[model samples]
Target: MDSMLKADTADVPARENAAERLAALAYDDMRRVDALILERLDSHVALIPELARYLIEAGGKRVRPMITVAAANMLGHTDMAPIRLAAAVEFIHTATLLHDDVVDESGMRRGKVAANLVWGNASSVLVGDFLFARSFSLMVEAGSMKALGVLSAAASTIAEGEVRQLSAVKDIGVSVDTYMQIIDAKTAALFAAAAQVSGIVAGRPSDEEAALETYGRELGLAFQLVDDALDYGGAAAQLGKSTGDDFREGKVTLPVALSLKQAGPDEAAFWRRVIAETDQKDGDFERALDYMHEHGALNATVEQARDHAARARAALSGFPDNAWRRALGDLADFVVERAY
Candidate 1:
């Protein structure tokens, strides 16, 4: 379990310039806010700090936290509360990543060894729990019960989504509906909570809050969709894991699910045998990839991701034109275009 966000080749260009964009969203002192996050994340337990630092220092794009800060700035709040909220969102996200890596048995993240790989699963899981609890305490400090409610619900949804994915493993019949449900819970719920909480903290009207929630939900869907696509299309070094790792794990992503349905008899038969069999050989990945390409599922999946990205950008129309809002729009475009 690594708390780090995987940086795709598609994300690098946007990230390289993220500092400049972030600077445009002014606060009283953004650096002080960052320092607050670092200080608050500290723990008395030595091991907690060690494992947590591995994740914090692993260097994520910190995009979710950025969204929280940006949304608050757009709504005219530049207080410490927004910074605390942003840090809470990052903690929640990082905790989920730690748990996910343990569940997924991910070996590498961000071009480095995964926490689970370096520290072992037992320590990683416990450290993840500590971070999750720390996030809740930080949320309480924000003094908005509405924000707490939204975030707590999101955490529950994320867990459920992970469990749903576990149940769907090796099940070739996992429909798009099931996949959508998983992504909505596992990915979009957190994003929605992050944006919605930002609005709540800023005392935004309900309608505006709803709009931000929608924006986050759609953006998250687009982000995860592109992530699924990259699992098939990216290089091992670039992806920070082996290509076709999803298929190798018998995890049915969007591309494979669509491919299984559209495949002709021979291809479909291959999918059936490979998916149903618990003991998948090394060759299964190669064959599954070939099937995905032949059936045009890979391209179709990328198109679906792009469609979501477009929808995400469109959702920002509710916000007034500002540098932060415009940057948000550009970030949406960055999410999809980076897949190239």
Candidate 2:
């Protein structure tokens, strides 16, 4: 354990509160985004507003919007474009969450009752569609075809990613590259777009835009890797759901894939029965944890996340040292650190 902690922190710089750092950097603009969200969330249909508000106001970290704002600030943007785009980014993310909760059949989100659980799956999905429409409309209102195209492409990619993931679930033979591809599309695509479009709106050069996109993609990948580890390593309260959710759902994340690769024949059969067949017995989660630890899969997953976090920081190398850059680097560190 001591050696694992040392290795995890090897290239990772210390950052006590990376999210708060990024939030403070973009606090004022985030407020504007918040106002715009409330304004745009309004609808004559009572259920639309109610369900949208419930999910939007839910205590998510709002990392995607913050990434949008931070990338804009990093590129010397001072206009309201970032603020407006930030709202659109938030809507895209919230829409995904609403839909995801229903699809995952999740009972909880951000430590509260899932919208689907409270309102029903039908309402949750429709509200998610409504938010998607609102997000696109917002991009149109922003009047940047380039930004609109970036986000629009991201939306489609995210859907495709989701579809790809649906196929991979319960298929224990999924490779690490396939797992990374799934996360890149489903999660990192938005992060990349949210950051890249800010550069576009700020009129940053193409290289800089690409750099921001890389930064966001690596950060998103690192974030998801950490989340995968946390499912087995973290307590239920920390996850806002039961631990081993990926295992129970028959989802094949990195830890599962890695452990499966290293499993003996007896262990492999156990995984096939539980994951491929979805026949979980009592203490299966505990045994899964034991396998993850025994094979060093969880620690390996965290180490890989730290590597992506480092890549995220390296992507910011061309940018000047400033609050935005610093906070973004810290945020990368915090993503990997969260696994601990």
Candidate 3:
């Protein structure tokens, strides 16, 4: 397991590592946005503030907020609105993570103990609500009804997607279309909103706004697909969670869906029984993985992710050639390359 983890980790590339990639933007602005995120996250309530702070400090890649900033900069907006929007996006995202941890009964996040694990599910859920409300307040401060519309719709879509995924749990007959819908709503919607809101805030042309939205949606879809793949392929320690955690939870993801579709009758029956019964033994996960490997479902899912990455890159064609745009492309590639 350790050797496999090392191998996978080694294969993943760092996103936006080159200094030249970020040279177009003023580092001072980026630092300012970082400070803004911290400052806006503050709350007077003792427990909520502490718990929210714990989750914020848990070291996410901040990819969604970065997308907002990059998109705004690409559209020639260097104002504080972008910074506030970036922080707003992060707050929304972090709230979702808190709720997600409770739903998944997750014990760890980004190699640290999860808020729910440390503070209990009730506390985590309430703090998540606080963040959600705070996110909307921040958006209101942005003073754009268009921005509010986009973000509010995204939030609703994400909820619907979560509910859809819950309905599909342990159901082996879940189709690729269903899987795509779930991911598009749950994962890609916020990315689309983030980029679109940035464009809206910058008063970009309709075409530019559409392009940014497309880029964000495709990038987010690809990111989640890679994440689902890693959940099965990654090491438990490196993932900061258990391997086959999704399977154990009876969550049907893309790779598993494809594998089920391709499985022989006996293998299909085994999957149905294990999943329906929620009786996942070590051998059950191994068998499911072996079937996925034999049917090339894992590779198929990876190919799909690569296709989305290509689409995301193509969406950036309308943007001017600049360091930020180039770095956005690099970031898309990194999403597919990350091991966990």
Q: Estimate each model's TM-score.
A: 0.89, 0.93, 0.90
Sorted on lDDT, best first, the list reads: 2, 3, 1
Off by more than 4 A, model 1: 1-33, 234-242, 278-283
- Model 1: per-residue Cα lDDT over 1-340, one tens digit each: 0111333444444334433356445444456556766787787788887887788778777778888888887777877777888888888888988888899998777667889989899988999998899898889999999999999999999999999999898898899889989999999999888888989998988988998898889889888877887787631213334466677778888888888788889877787777756566777777777777777777777777778777877877878898888877767766765455
Please give the distance, in angstroms, between residue 306's alpha carbon in candidate 2 and its true position after superposition.
0.6
Listing every candidate in turn, what is its Cα RMSD in Å to the true structure after a full C-alpha superposition?
4.4, 4.3, 3.8
Best by lDDT: 2
Q: Please, what are the lDDT tens digits per residue for candidate 2 over residues 1-340?
A: 3232443333544332677667777889888899999999999999999998887787678899899988888878878888888899999999999999988998788778999999999999999999999998899887899999999999999999999999999999999999999999999999999989899999988999999999999999999998888888642213334477788899999998999999999999999999999999999888888888788888888889899899989999999899888898888887787777
lDDT of each: 0.78, 0.87, 0.80
Query: Which 10-residue window in model 2 sums to the lowest lDDT?
Result: 1-10
Q: Which model, 1 or 3, shows the larger TM-score?
A: 3
lDDT of 3 at 63: 75
In candidate 3, list every pair of residues with a backbone clash.
none
lDDT, candidate 3, residue 306? 81
